[model samples]
Structure formats: structure tokens, C-alpha cells
Target chain A: MTLNRRAFIGTGAAMAAALAAPAVRASNHGKPRVIVIGGGAGGATAARYIAKDSKGEIDVTLIEPTRMYYTCFFSNLYIGGFRDLSSIGHSYGTLAQSGVNVAHDWATGVDREARTVTLAGGAVLPYDRLILSPGIDFVEDSVSGWDVSAQNKMPHAYKAGSQSELLKAQVEAMPEGGRFAMVAPPNPYRCPPGPYERISMVAHLLKEKNPTAKILLVDPKEKFSKQALFEEGWNRHYAGMIERIGPDFGGDNVSVNPDEMTVDIDGVVEKVDVCNVIPAQKAGRICEMAGITEGNWAPVIPHTMQSRVDENIHVLGDASNQGDMPKSGFSANSQAKVAAMAVRGALLGSNVFPAKFSNTCWSLIEENDGVKVGASYEATDEKIVSVSSFISQTGEDADLRKQTYEESIGWYSGIVSDMFG
Target chain B: MNWKHDRFWGVLATVAGVGLATPVVAEQQDARIGDAEAGKEVYDLCVGCHEVGPDAGNGIGPHLNGIFGRRAGSVEGFRYSKGLSREGRLGMDWTLETLDAYLENPKALVSDTRMSFDGLEDKADRDNVLAYLRQFSDSPQNIPESAPTGRAREVGLSQETLAIAGDPEFGEYLSNECTTCHRIDGTYDGIPGIVGWPEEDFVIAMHAYKRKIRPHPVMQMMAGRLSDEEIAALAAYFGDLE
Candidate 1:
């Protein structure tokens, strides 16, 4: 088990489509219906927790496009060859076993006032409570010349799975001394430490396979999560191998010409053997379609994860504009537990505990060099804020780092079991 | 210049978790203990096996309601390990000192116990967990007087690790595991609470648990895991809470 955030986001809810439909399960048990629009970390966990805890009291229906989910958290380890792709992928069979009506279909439209969801398969499902944990989506036109059409050429392995495979193949195929470039995303994105970890993983691969090869990081932000630790790791493990250009050096204003296989940074174009263009991210499009979003993300009450505009809907994970919490799988899972408790209390009249949340973000710099940052949070009148926090220092010993890495493995196993089983 | 050794030095100076090795001889500052709030967080690790509170029941492990002062191996339907049953025959109660010893090394205290957990390593963690445990009991066991002020005051229970009084808020998070056996709001089945006791009482009980004076294998193993700082923090949290 490794670290990765797996988002369960609805496909295209709010965009009505006409296709031959299968009859979606209606509320059969006279129980309140919970229609979860995604089956990844947040959605699946909420569905599982609510359904299992309710003991057949509430009906849970999970709609997801893919039967298998590839976690975005540890997909970097796959590229670094620490794990296989199969290990990062999970199925929804476990959720179904827990009595979740796992529906494999696209969520095309939503009638919020009507409290109904239209599926691409021509099914209209009604709900008493809708939990929308649609993961992130690239903000359209945020990066010039790098659209969905150009994904194959400049893969944003940020989504995991096939994209991860593609990027790995490209890295493996890079000619000796060839240049590899990355177009990093802006702040407040999924997994703040993600790109830097990817950089470390790539550097690990290149160091072993192609020592002479170089990596160029064009980062929009001047600083990043675990900057000091990452810098130290890079210097120790891959010194003189990776170079980063920050905002002051025009790293923010950048574009990739897929047609020419070049990254134009500050009026300078650099042709590379491979390129990773991670565009700006936003709340899942379904959130915007449901009219729950203010700018790019849906806002929710911290304690319950309920939408500010509509209490019937709850948003979690990357789609929700939660203060001080990262948009990672751990965060999503924690939020889901809180939401599940609140939802159970609302629907089943169960006792609801005051919302308390905690999250830890772990990143591997090398094989056994792992660093972590975590905090416990409480929902205040204004927002979810940190109560206490801890981080790995710059000059930790191998034994401690090894222990930290082991702790992450334990967390991964614990979370994966919690989410899927 | 040595990357690996620098990390080694960093570990010695770690601010959180079990032991640290920075020798500081400053002013005699008041020793604040673990936050019950933070102990709640650390208790998350134990949730999978144990259950606490009124709704709590026997899961993978026995329900930990009314644990302190309750006889060992006496959770009615729960099958106690041979060592625990033997200790129960000896009429052992869960004193804080005994709990500290048992948590520090469960297997060493009670061999062949059914529990699969590794004990806490930080003294603060053990003390905080014990404090968190105390929150569920109406009448916790009496605190031992004139106990050796735990090396935990400045150093961890372990010889190599240094200890610090942790934030109870964080301890609350760490105590997620403890809630599997002991609930936070003073509800109990087989376990007990320290929620309303003074911090000093909680600390003495934990030292008893750690020294194996009380002979429950589960407590021995669980106590073994925590450092002095963690125990101190737990005391502050559970003792200060209402």
C-alpha cells in the first residue's frame, strides 16, 4: 500500500443525454435514498459507511463511469517502479457487496430542485440526499495548446493509470542525455506535494537508467509543499540532475506546442524528449453544473459537508472549497467520514459526533526516504482550521525515514481497506 | 555533506513522535501534558479492533468498557488469553502503572495474547491513551503516590528517545485507535475514563501500567508503544477534560 488520492467524480451530470436506458433501482425498502455521484475515495467511502452503518435503513446508489479506480496518490510510485499498475487500481465490487447499488454509467444531468439525477444510460434516479465528490477537472483553456486532444502527446499523468503508463513509456524511451520537461500547475491543486514527488520519482528513474539525462521543472509557484525536504532529497539523491525555474524567471507563463513537441517558457522554446503539462485544476464539472460552485469549487459547511446553497447536497474531496485542508485522498476519506456521520444522523436520527478531521500527506523522495506532514482540524464557525500539526525535518536519519515510510504503507493499507472493504 | 547522517541528526531532534535526543538544560518550565483532544486523534489506530461507549460491543477485540479497576479477563463473554486469564485468577486490576507496562510490551507481559497490535512507542502517547481511557469510567483507580517522576518529564520512557508533553488536540487525533475500546465522552462498557481526574493521578496509573505492576497482556503491549511525552500529554488531556 502506498500513498495516492483516488477521486470518485461524476462524469457529466447536468448535461441531459438521450440514450436507451436500464431501469435504475428505485427506493425499494421505503428507506431514504442516497445517490452518490462518484465511486472513488469520497463517494465510495460515504456510500459504504452510510449503507453499512445504517443496517438496511437507507438505500445507497453509487454511480461511477469506471468499474475500476486508479488512485492518483501512489501512481508516481508505479512510474518509479516501486509498485505495479494493478496494485493501484481498485474495483467497486466490495461496495456492491456492502449493499450499495453500484451503477456503472455516466451521470449526465441533475435536477437539483426535483432532486433527480439523469444518467447517460437514460436512467433518472431520485434521491433524498446527494453526495457529490466529483474529483478535479482541468480548467478549460487554462493552458494554451494543451487540451484534452493533446493529452496523449503531453500526458498529465496526474489522473493516473493509462496516463501513468504512457508517461513511463515515454520516460523509458527518452534518448541518452535527452531533456525532459514538466509544466507544473498553480497552487491550491490536488496534492500540493504531488508534483514534487513525481519529480523525485522521475529523477530516481533517470538516475538509475539515464544518469546524463536532465529534468526541467517550470513551476508557477515560487515555493512548494515540503520544499526544504524535497530540495534536500534532490540534492542528495539527484544533485545536478534536476533544475527548477520559478515564477520570477517566468516559469508561470508557459505553454506546450504539442504539434512541435516543445515547451515555450518566457519566450524561449525548449524541445524535449518528453513533456508533462499539468494544467490548472478546478472543482469537478458536475459541481458547477449543479450550480453549487461560486467560482471554481463548491462551498460547504465544514462540519457536515453540506452545500451552502442547498443542504440536500454534500460536497467532499477536491471539489469542495475547504479551508486549510489539502485535496488529497486522505482528506477526502476524512471528510467522507464526517459527512457520513452527519448524513446518518440527519436521515436515521443517529447520534452525530461533533466533526473532527485529520489528514497526513506522505511523499517518498527515494526508496526508503519518506517525509510527511499532517494536522488535526476542527470545524469552526468560519472554516475547518488546523488545531495541531507535525512535519518531518530536513536532516532526519535513515531509520526514522524508513519508519515514516513504513507508517505510510500502514496508512495506505488501512485506508484502502476502509474505503473498499 | 553526509546526506544520510544529516537525516540521522534530524531524527534525534524530532519534535513529535516517541523520543528525541536534543540535550537542552534551560529554565525549569512547567511540564504541560498531553491534550485529551490530541489523544483522540492518536486513538484512531485502535478503532478497527476495539469498541468503547454504550453502543460499543465485542468486535475483533473485546469491548473496553469499565477497564480501569475492573478485573482482567473479566469482560463476560470475551475469551481472554491464557496469560490474561492467569493474571485475572491472581485478581489484577488495571492500575495506571500496570497499564503503562503492559502497553509498552504486551507480549512480554502476557505471551500468546489474541491482540495483533504493536504497543505505542512514545511515553506521552501511552499516558495520553491511558488518560483517554480514563474518560469513560465514573470512578477511575487511585493514583500511585511518590512514583518515580517518569523520565517522561524530559525524556521518553525508552532510554534512547527524548519525550515532550504533546498537544492534546493532536493526541485526540492519535487516540482514534483508543476509541475502538474507550469512548471519548465518558461512555464505557469494559474500559474506563480519566476525563475528570487530576493529571497527576492519571500519570501515576500509567506508570504502573508501563512497569508491569498490573499484569494485563493487552495493557502491557499497548503501554510499551508510548514514550514519556505521549503519556504526559494523555494525562493532561484526560485529567483536564470534564
Candidate 2:
């Protein structure tokens, strides 16, 4: 069987690799093309790795709607006045300069049969491999009487950028001694410690600007990540400033009225000055458009992050249902490297090592008080399983806490560079 | 390194201290001498600057928690005088003998110590104060039956592992886990730089963390799972970064 360029495009990669000569790519079939959608932690890292490691052997194109990406990891610090908004925002200029063809447009549709993606700008991109790391989107009507349109009245600063700025402005402009309410999301959300961290930042802000201002946290889960650490910090730093209602207190049965600026928790409606309603989450709409999601997320093989339904596409970050690892920027960045390696090995026959995964989350409770939780993981046939883990002890010295906070600053710089460059 | 010699001295001091106590010697052979109850009264004089306890924080002087087994003038966030900093640089650790000597004559030990205290003329007073200070420090020699502190290197490397030839290409791939917090550019922004380190030093440091010798919890957890070959690979990769 003669392996021509036309036949190479039609056949599966595995079959062609076994039959065709290695020089076939250089002689006739041009570089294997990879189209990575969503230029955030997962997509950016994957695209950059494939482009850089392949050494011009593979054509990589990154499709993302936002040119300046605002990282959600440090947006809470901005809310607490520890960082400037500009510091957390990054541009894709560096990535574009380094081999990757940056496409500033939204992905509208995916045709798995034709192996092509349609953009909102009416451009169709064909690829031998596709990576979808679209992060997360709020589930439609996940919270009663709330939708994306109501975001202006009740900001869900989960995605960062302008929403974060607006939320900060709203919090700052609240009436003296006003009430701030947060409707937290359920289990299996992006950044397991995010909502609690945001609360800490809000409490930090209130302590400075309005000491009498109170925070009401309504959470659906019975317990949360780093609950003991957060509780201890809250007691020490922001005593009487914050109150949390867990599942036992009808927190799961929550509804909000953005127009009325009120929240209904178990038939008790409370007026609030600013409401942060973080609704339940699902994989980005692009994953659903590609018809790869199961239930609310795209399930992928832990080893390669390849979609269970389609071998041509790999899902990453918050969109991927890779077991054990949380939905975080750090987790996404880690998974992206593994996926990038697998993609290169599949497309260009590069060395693919056994997949190793790890993640750590640091949350600031006050000025110099920080806590963290982390775990190292390895891929088994069943799932990515945690083998070793650690978390900050409740009563640590101020020096260690301050060191942790500084380390987080360094991590912010390190990760943004890792993702963008 | 005189680590073994230092341990012997620590054990000897503990034994000598045990001879002075009657009932306390039954609980631990390394128990310090002097009345801790009476030393509480002696601590009143040092309370103007020094602090000790759960919520103890740095005042004019550094907080005294975990002072045992710690190097002199090495507390974070405190600006040590030139004399104490030099003593710490010269490897002056605060053990039973060192602390007692410093307490006996601050000026004689560290010529330019910022501490403005006269020498304790009474031997009994110095003994009591040293015992009271020892209560705040957790010496591994004093508490051998307690859970092994994460600061001890419990695991040792096999000669075979120490001799493994690392693959640099594999090292680059494995380094992704480290570059999350450590800058590949070698910038030390709160986190220490790892790029361009000597391979041997890198391997030794990682193994120390792997063995739970390092104090950082995150580093311990990260290094705990890495195989010997993986550590060697990372060392090789980071060594060649420059």
C-alpha cells in the first residue's frame, strides 16, 4: 500500500505510522497540524510545548477569544488590594512571537468527522490533532433566578478580567456596615479553594475599608477544601466579620434575586449590598459543541488526556474529568505538559514518558497568613491516583506563613510565564 | 561536618543535666536540670524583648519558639546585629551549652549582641533560665519517642542510586513539576532559584527533601514520590539550563 499525502490525511495516525516511511512527512505530507482551542493555562501550555519541543516539525495554531488573559489564580489578591489588576492580566504576544500561530477568535463549532473546527469569524481550521482546554462555564440556570445577563447586578467574578474589577468596585462602594453575601458553588468546581479564598480577600477588604461590614457565605457542601485552615485564620484575623452556612443550614436550597439585591436561603430572604453568586459549572460550551462531554465534563484517559469518545481530540484543565486532580490553573498546567508530550509522541514519534501529576493550592487569609494543600499523583489504569499529599498545619509560625505568601507571589509569576511563554 | 560531634555533645549535656533531677530523669535521660517553675520567675527579666509560647511573635528580639536545634541569629524577619549574624554564619547553633554560655555573658559570647542584658552572676539563675528556655525548644535528643520531626533525614540513598546516569531529555520533561513555582530563568522571587545549580548539590538537596529532612512541607511531598532516577534526571536537566 503506497502511503500518499491524500491517504495519510484519510487514515488513522497509528495505521499510517506503522506503514509509511519516516521520511514521508518531510518529503510529501507537510507538518502534522495541531489546533489548540482556549488559550488559558491548559491550552497555552500545550500549544507552546508542542510548538517549542517539535522544533518546527509540527504546525501549531492557538484559538482564543481574549487577547489579554486575566489569570483567575491571583484575582482574589487584586480584590484584597494586594495586587494591581494589570499585574494579573497577561497578553499572548510572547506566545505568538514563539512559533505558535495565535488566532484571536472564538471557536463556534467542531466537526469531528471532517476533522475541522469552525470559528465565529467564519474561518475553518483543519488539524490532525485537536486540544480543547476551554476551562469552565456556568451551568444554565444552575442557580434559580440567575443567568449570564444578570452578571452585572450580581457579579460572578469566577472568570476574572472586567468582572473582577467590577466586583472590587462594588465591594469598595458598599454602604458603611453593609452586608456582603456570597452564594458558593457545589463540589467539583474550578479551584476548590477559590470561593473561600475570595471570602478571605473580601474579609480583608472589609476589615480595612469598612470594619463593620459583614460577609455571609452560603455554601452547598457540608465541608470544603482546607476548611480547618480557613476557619482558624478567620477566627484569628477576621473574628465576627464572617459567617458561613453549610448544607445543614439550608445553604444548598439557595436562590438569589439580582434585581432585588437579595438572597433566599431556606425561605429566609436577606438583603445584601453586593452579591457574589458563583453558580455550578460545566465544561466550556465548545466541548459540548464538539459532542465529547459526558454529563457536565469531558472524560479523558488519564495517561494522554485524550477524549474517551474521540482519539483525535484531547481535553484538559477544568474541562477534563481526569480523576483525583482538582480543577485549578496549576493542575491544568501540569496536565497540559503530559498531553503535549502524548500529542507529540502520537504525531511526531517523540519520546513519551509515564504521566506524573501534581497540584498545590495556596490561599491567603490575611496580610501575611497563608495556607496550602497539595498532592502528587500517578496514572493507573483506573484513574490518576494520589500517592503522596501534604497540607499546612493549623498553628504555624508567622514567618512560615509569610514565606508561604511570598512563595505564592513567585508562583504567580512563574505560572503566567510558563503559560504565556 | 561536625554534626556527629555536635550530637555527642548534645547527648552528653542531656546526661549531665539528668543527674541534677530526681523524678525527671526517670521520664527522659536527656532532661535538662534546674527548676523550670523557678525559671518562670527568672524569665520575667527577659520578657521585655523576648517572647515565648503559641502566639509568641517577634518583639525587639526574635520569638523564642523552636529555639532548640536552631542556629543562632537565623530567625526569619528579625534583623540581627553584626556580631550575632557572624556567630550564626560561623555555625553557632543554640544548644544547651551555647545558650547557657550566651546567657552567662552575652557580651563575652557575641561581642556586639543587640541584647542589652548584663551577665547573670548567679550560676543557679543562669541554670534555671536555661532550663525554662529549653522548655520552649523541641530537641529531638530530648524527645526521642515522639513522632520523627520532618526535619530529620530518615532515609539514606543506595550507592547504586547515587551512581545512576541521568537522561537530560527526560529531565527536561520531569522538570515541569518544579518550574511551576521555581523560575526557569533562575529568578528568586520568594522561591529559591534552581537553574544552573551543580548536579551533585541538586541531587543531595532533593534527596534530603525526599527523606523528609527538609523543613518545607511542599518540597517534601513533591520529592517524596520522585524515584532516584527522576531526581538524577532533574538534577542533570537543571544543571545544564545555563
Which is the leading candidate under DockQ? 2
**Per-prediction TM-score, chain B alone:** 0.46, 0.47
TM-score for candidate 2, please give it. Answer: 0.73
Instruction: Give the fraction of reference interface contacts each candidate recovers.
Output: 0.00, 0.22
| TM-score per candidate for chain A alone | 0.93, 0.94
lDDT (10s digit) by residue, model 1, range A193-297: 889999999999999999999999999886677788999999999999999999999998898899899998999989999999899999988898889999888
**Candidate 2 lDDT tens digits, B161-209:** 2332243566787798888889889988888899999999999999999
After superposition, candidate 2 runs with Cα above 4 Å error: A1-29, B1-166
Q: Give the lDDT of residue A115 in candidate 2.
A: 82
Q: In model 1 chain B, which range of ten residues has the least summed lDDT?
A: B140-149
Q: Per-residue lDDT for B1-242 in model 1, tens only? A: 12222232223224112222233222211112233455677778878988887778888888876676577788988887898999888987765667777788788777887787788888778766765665554320011111111112222233222222343543443343343234455643334544666878877777777787875333443454455566676777776667
How far residue A54's Cα lies from its native spot in candidate 2, in Å, is 0.6
**CAPRI-style quality class for the chain A–B interface of candidate 2:** incorrect
- Residue A414 Cα positional deviation in candidate 1, in Å, after optimal superposition: 0.9
